[model samples]
Target chain A: MLGRIEQKVLRGGRLTPEEALALFETDDIHLLGRLADTAAERRSRGRAYFVQNRHINHTNLCLNRCRFCAFSRSKGERGAFELSTEEVLERLEGSPEGLSELHMVGGLHPEWPFEHYLELLRAVKERFPRLGIKAFTAVEVDHFSRISGLSLRETLARLKESGLDLMPGGGAEIFSEGVRKRLCPEKITAERWLEVHRTAHELGIRTNATMLYGHIESYADRVDHMIRLRRLQDDTGGFQAFIPLSYHPFNTEIRGGRPSGIDDLRTIAVSRLVLDNFDHIKAYWVMLGEKLTQVALLFGADDIDGTVVEEKITHAAGALTSEGLTREALIGLIRGAGKVPVERDAFYRELNLYGDRYEDRQGDGAEAPDRFRTARARQ
Target chain B: MRKRLHPEGVVTFVVDRNINYTNVCINRCRFCAYYRGPDSPEAFVLGRDELFRKIEETLEEGGTQILLQGGLHPGLDLSFYLEMLRSIKERFDINIHGFSPPEIHYIAGRANLTVGETLQSLRDAGLDSIPGGGAEILSDRVRQVLSPRKIRSAEWLEVMEEAHRLGMRTTATMMFGSVEGPEDIVEHLDALRGLQDRTGGFTAFIPWSFQPKNTELGETVQDRPLGAGGAEYLRIVAVSRLYLDNFPNIQASWVTQGIKMAQVALRFGANDFGSTMIEENVVRAAGVSYRASRRGIVDAIRSAGFKPAQRDTHYNIIRRL
Candidate 1:
């Protein structure tokens, strides 16, 4: 017999908490996959989207060393590093000319004034006016709010004025109160993290959402986390995508095994199904190994992240997936799945449509990398 | 593969009975063990009461359609088909998915009507869709050796074209692993693809192995393999998904391959589970009795990690689990 919630799904209605929880309990993983695929297809059609961006972790030195975090460090811990505004710009220079976005996130620095972050964003904008700077998780924002003595709205407004294009989805490890208490006690509360994004959305600063799974959280915890995000997406509509971050356990204070491949795929499929209103579901290749990332395209993930160059967050957690992939390689993965590869910007605008006729944008004679440099230099 | 392709995680099946209304056939294809000649005492055409009983049982089982197919009985006229369709449609308000191309061609020839006229008369009598039966291999070379007395390949395509022109939909099938090679499989898929490109009327593609037991062709075709295995079936299903890009849905034949292989095929690119066959006689006559109830199909699909959804004849979801 059809469950009442599943009957509503058949009738094209949104999922309730009871329905969401029931979806997890049901043994029908394929039905979960099918529902996720239907939702993904409804949003993306046959096109799988990715971007050409670089990740810049400004600093690793921090005050809050959350147990799940391997990237955060004490004042003089070995491998602790911080980049100045000039160093950040010099690193940005090495990126390919077609680089469209910058992903920036790091620990909560103790002594550095909030002016350092403002200057970093300003310097990045001054050097590459065309770059979209997606910086700061809600945790970092909360830290900044505490240090600067500003409200969430005012803190977000100041960051937006300083060239923060969007907010990176992080700090939402697991939403259950017990999970939050156990996972990252020093970090902002789950409600506070959501409030930061909610305020960002209300201020017209679109952001993404994420959930770190396969750790201490139960299945109910994961479902409740996604349901909260779904409800938030329903209210503000500022969430562009949902990335289900698989918990990698290597150097963390907690010692647990990583999720299996099937678990990763199931989480992605369920995330796609549960977050119906969100347009894109991302498979961060930096966390899910390269092959699984390609497989995830066929699962429920339409966005295989981007050419992340140097992604230190998951690497700190002992992730085996390569730190980055080239634009051509990303396109190859999407096309290998028999889907159209579209080059999208941070805000989901089509930068280029790489149809059946694939023109190598990296040094190919047809479309040279220097073309982007020339176009930007003209400005 | 299931999640990326469908994203909605809903795998669907229909609760319908494959009612072989008549077992008497004139074109008795060699590989078929189901048909009986008119002179045989065992030959039978369903009486009105029996047909209604089957249909009522179907409704009681929560079935939404009756897939009425059979051999081309020379004694039966077009009036018999028209009345059967009208009777079912008038009484039950259920979908009448009756008649393959060969049966339609045989009816047209017997009534001295054009294929279009025969389809129109059937449609007027409340025929909803055509099932792709008798399409063993679209290659005529194989057809010549397989079933020469049946309508040729061109005639089958012609009947489908006429049905599509009349704005009616149909399903396509390939009965492989019988005297045909890899090229023949490609040829079959290409033929279906070409027609789909023109008409865009095929709702789904079904591929099943040719069952050969207690049949003359099974013994006569020396050196020929009996049928394909699960691996081969999966390879063909995956290739069909890649080849038939225009085709929206591909079905796995759980009725032939059994439940386990069908469940595995969900990963190999089959989005639709063929049917919960409340009644199946044709394949059963060939000495393979694999039964599937609605609950069984739902369980199998759920085990495969997909949500089971009930669908009508048109592939529209009636309910979801």
Candidate 2:
């Protein structure tokens, strides 16, 4: 069974849903990893991507209290915070130079209208114009459309006009309706999420896609989720990357243990093999931790996400990784995996390739010069 | 090599529970997340009732031995350990495999006795064997960075040698993937092989990866791979199997690596699945919580094409499934 699938994958043929499911159930992890690694090398020519990006989770005062989310809170809750536009700007003010992107996502505020999100995006863009703004999930976009009494296309047009360069693929949890009903019933359905991304793509705004695994979802549900995204990507080549979010189970209404490292790596490998339309598969270090993320690079992941300065969402759910990683640390992690570290923008355009010439470039006053020096000495 | 080592095509595991008697420690190693200070709100020493209850449960569940270990509490003397061991022995007829070298060395220093004297006293108090807990890298160069306050390499080896000379068997372990290079790992294996050649009292060699979730070392070592990966783990298992020719057994740590990777390790070189670990808190404190029942271990071994057997502390087959 795997032989036929391997031949199809190696020969650049699309995998049927049954074949992908078989790949998921197979215990031959080494062969699965090897095939996925070959597929990844074909897509990305040995260059792993990272961005000098910062995350701004503006508010946690959410209306739809998803059972799987520990980051959201009620309005009067003790830890619920709503950052004003000035506070958001102030948070970005502390960001280091050479920062290429600002990833902003938050809970659905019940009171704030859609204009508030537009104003926030415009304010961030007017201040840090060079930082590409990757803001909002498809779920948030649908909420914006409903709040503003506008169509989905109109709402996305206003957001794009307000300097939203890209959309992060969050809130897509699992596309299977059975799991979605229990996971986050109040949130938008899978069809609406896909519609929001499709409209965003039609309006010339690229985005990424994600699937939240390691919760109550099954292997079949995961394969279904990826196939849905692959079908969408097949129509609109808009997804720049596909991220498999490892479900961190801490302080959530659905309190389950985190998945094993084997499950995490297998999900990454299967996503790379199944999501053939996606050019990049990100091992988001904020959730996977640095060590597992390094191993994921060998298991068919081509991106380590980014430096992820001040990632509050996963940390709010008891992520053990640091809130942020220095640029030198990201480089060290990628290099330690024996891959070329290519610093990319929000759209994954190569901004700086830290290859063999990285040592010489370290002396030219990169960020955290002392730390970079120490990293060099260690190498 | 695997076939030559095990001609009967059997993989063995011990049905034991790691009972940490106390959490208070003075020599808090950086890579350890299980130790607590003397005055911390979470510091605790198991009472006699709780210890006996745990042993009774283990015995009820067909567990043959108790891997009794603990942190070196500053307030507890040798009498505390002696009482704990003697009380358990008086209550239950189970094998008591307790105390790594660092704990023995610390107890010896506190009581002003030699290593041999400490082993003799513990044996007299009903310690059946010793476990290898605190031997992180077995190189002074690496030990200085990881655990300077703990026992030195020579002291750890001296305590193990003393136990062997006392006719008490012990296991050896290596916690790699933390601030150590390949040379350091080689040095650790070389030290274990040399000792096994001399004494032949070392029962098995277990190499588990260093899980760096809640440890201070995880915070400091941010630039490199925090711990060894699955491939590196398999490489270490294969190398240890080939290098330590005098050692009789190699254990795959499912506590650190999950069941799937542990099954893969059986193909690499491991002849034993380490333990069922009905209760494990040390790795849980490190943010990795992997649990396996005896049925799960047996199933994993059978699926990996090896016969599963339950063994005691001395690797004697107590039952075959």
Candidate 3:
């Protein structure tokens, strides 16, 4: 019964922790790996992908004091900062050229009119009409909705009309209230975060999902986070990927915390093993560094995040990354890991291999059934 | 190699900077939202001067080591690393605890050298040790599905073993919580345990969660099971101490799990508080929140009902915990 559901949920044909831990003690490591490998491989079947874009932190100024945040700057703080559209556009221009997407998000400012964001997107679109904008998290959306007295749909629609292509997965720190209250109490509740994402999906705008792990949360809570996301994905099919956000406990409001390496690995492996509906398991290179991210691939992560020509919020949080990247460097890292380097669009669709041509990216349309069958037979 | 963290009278610890020389990478592993492509204006390889400046800063701050790691970029040559290591050694008094399994594998493949020879060359060039990295859930099934193109389970261990025999001490790791079943977790443990029984080279075993942000995978499924808590984290810590019987010191993962869990881990299994990390990115980008001070490590260990001891990268407790 246990293995049955395990396979159904993850397709890895493994048993639950309660069952597997018992066998692990007895040194049945091979059987265990087989089961985990299966589940991980199948869970993210077509979705292990990454995007080519840049991240823009419009402002670190905020009214709320979310506990888990290290990047938020109170308006009165010496470190508080807000970028004008011109400043943001300068940052965008400095963004790696040929980038098709712009990832914009920051704190929910109390003073900036909601239309400030709209205007920012509008200006960017007018300046770079071809570039897609995947901006704002659910919490930011909630902040905008309340501040503007607009419905979630109306808000998203207005943004879309203003060039908001999609939503960036943020603010879903964890689904458990116990943890939320202790970690980020002032932020939108987990339910509201989900509601906004659900609303975004309902409106036909795709978004991403994330979990900021390695902080004050439990294994069950991690599992609950995944189950809830799976259910949501089943409902909307709007979530394009699952990025495991590693919580960095530095310059943050929280106390008594540090990063957990093993826990991070467990989350990634387990995510691929259990999140049967999600496609991609990304190692956010910015957070995990390339070494762990590369290792994450073997553990069940297929996608490495894209070129962040400029990542502000993390830098403001003291990420130490002050420079952007060139595509050659990225391809070098992927190929160095012995994986094929493919560039992806804002959505999960494959644009082509890093070095492949547009025509080469042309999906061969449905693998010749016989070819895959033969390949499987060869296996 | 007697790779054991034997407690000594002096609590020896070294100051180091984890120089991720470059954020440029090709592997688009989900759970990662970092890494820029070549030509990505964001992309960069730490030039010698830039790296030297970092080392100079660390040295100025009394740092004695450098844990240099980066994505598996194809352009870097063995000479590149050799030059960097040589430069660091030539410039400052620093120990190089750099490179992981996948990196060695890539280096070997790129240079057409064996893992043993690769370690041998790097060690000859002032490379001191390897971190417990990329040993994410060590199941081929999980590896193929998640990072299909990276090293396989056997390869990861094989590289570690090669490092062990090559006289390079290394660490083992398990990244759980994604799609892995309990059995998969077990398999990861057993693999590490068996390796320890053989080579006894793995200095410590660390486990962590996945961080999904700014990546392709971050676009799909909502991150579930949030993250491990003190209780669950302790359970794993205790289990590792209990399970990796051949392994002696299990380092509490203060880097990803935080100090509270690290303190709790001492009771369960972990005896060593990890390095006084000057900089860490991978897990932080995934959103794990916290940083530990050297004094904080001492305090946390004391609070956890143990003496806080400082140790070198080799697990030899210089200070009593």
Candidate 4:
């Protein structure tokens, strides 16, 4: 008899909540990987999408210090730092030329007014008008709405006017109430986080979604989280990609080991299967490390996030993957997996298509006698 | 080794049927399971009705050609091949990619004609092109052990070189992972490379693993390997692309590797998806039963991130999708 999940997958039907939970229990990692890979291939057509962008974490000091986060620091604490507008501009000046996006997300600050964020965005945009600024997470947006006493839509619009081109998908630590209450009770509720993104989508602001996994979250909780993201994507069509952030537990209140490589891959594969409406599924190399992210490309991940320079949040949580990767190195990683390395921009617009070096040799029977002799001698 | 050797993003395949006309091969090689002795129950050539039926079905499936290759039947005269080709050409507007180098050599010897004269006669009867059959491993040592009664490596190249001189195009193939080692494989490739250097008449090079199941050779080996997995297949494909510089196209044999690995081959220097074998018997007789329809080939090519196209036997684009 065919298993229910297999039946659903073979029929190309949407995975139900129960079926997804069942699939999450499957130990046949290759099956799940193949299923996810088939789905990803159908969508992306063998081209893994990535971007040349810079990550800017503006501040690490926050009022709501979630247990899962190690970057948020109390006021006056050691290693606590916040970037002023001048400091942000100075950091921007160090970014490599031809960067297409500026990704910014940091802790919720207690004293900085909403205008501080606006001024920082404006200054960066004035410096590089072509750079798409994908700043702030849903939690940051909600915090902005609350502190500024503006509606979610109004706050998003004001930020949009202030040059916030898109929203980052973060702070959606598993959508289950139990997981949220334990890991981050002070943070916004799961419903509120979705509502913030929904409002952003309604305001014509494209956003990405993320789920932090491998920390006190059940298989059911992970499935439910992705299903909810898929539901929102179905309604809004706003989520550009769904990223399953592997939880890092170094120097954090939540004391547990990091997710195993299999766990990380399973989550990524399950995300690709469940988030059917999401076009891109990302393996954030920063969180999952570089090796696992490379493997995740075959496990249904078509995006390796980006060449994020100087990432602090995951690095603070003890991520051992390099703080940054060169664009050439990133292209090599994708090519090593036998995929076309496409350099995409902030909005997933393909900036440059890096054709593999071997693909260009036309072999026009053009023979160089010396080179042929050398090759023959070596063989 | 992801190279775009072709300017067009489209990966081309031929919608053709590999219709074996005769199973009564005189050389009953040890590596083959499809051939039979003339007295065997299955050692019968396809009658005109069966041949026309296969052609009709191929055309119905939107196939533009038929890969008509067969064993060297001892009794069948060269006139038999000519009449079959003429009848197919008169009846249907399908390309007849008939006869391989070995078959051409055998037919010429039996009819007391030169290889050029034989190929010209077949071409006049509307033999559009030739399939690269029976050029398994162009190393005589491998050929002696695998199929001793068959033509030698040089004779195979001689037939192809002569066909090219007669203005006829053909494909080249290698059936490796049998008794051939890396040096022998290189020798095989070197022969094709050398011949192609002089006469660039070869359209593509297809390297497929020797399917061992149900074959006499499969039964003879005590510890038979799993043939060529994707990694080995990919390595050969990559090397073939780098080595066979004179050849324009490399084909991924989905008949033996299945569709997914064949799709992966598009990135591994294979610019063509061989053929959607509407009717295949050789590999099927070897106990690997992978089938590809026209739509399946198109989807496989597209899934591999290339535009899928239909091409003629000569690698000319027939239609692009």
> Largest TM-score belongs to which candidate?
2
Q: What is the DockQ of each candidate?
A: 0.01, 0.21, 0.04, 0.01
Tens-digit per-residue lDDT, B184-222, candidate 3: 889999998888888888877777766444545545533
Clashing pairs in 2: none
For model 1, residues A241-325, the per-residue Cα lDDT tens digits are 8999988777888866556445676788877777888888998878775545655676678998899999898888866545777
Chain B: TM-scores of all predictions: 0.97, 0.98, 0.90, 0.97
Residues B193-309, candidate 4: write the lDDT tens digits.
999999999999999988777887876542222344444676788899889988889998888876656765666688999899988888889877755568778866774567998
Candidate number that wins on lDDT, 2 or 3: 2
- Which ranges of candidate 3 are over 4 A from the true structure? A1-48, A320-323, A354-379, B1-320
Query: Lowest-lDDT window of 10 residues in candidate 4 chain B?
Result: B221-230
Each model's fraction of native contacts: 0.00, 0.11, 0.00, 0.00
Q: What's model 4's interface RMSD, roughly to a tenth of an angstrom?
A: 14.5
Please, what is the whole-model Cα lDDT of each candidate in the order they appear? Answer: 0.82, 0.87, 0.69, 0.82
**lDDT of model 3 at residue B278?**
76
Give the runs in model 1 whose Cα sits over 4 Å from its true position.
A1-7, A357-379, B1-321
Task: Give the Cα error of residue B2 in candidate 2, in Å.
Answer: 8.1
Ranking by TM-score: 2, 3, 1, 4
Score candidate 4 by TM-score against the native. Answer: 0.53
Interface RMSD of 1: 13.9
TM-score of each: 0.55, 0.79, 0.56, 0.53
On the 0 to 100 scale, the lDDT of residue A16 in model 4 is 84
Instruction: For candidate 3, please provide the TM-score of chain A on its own.
Output: 0.84
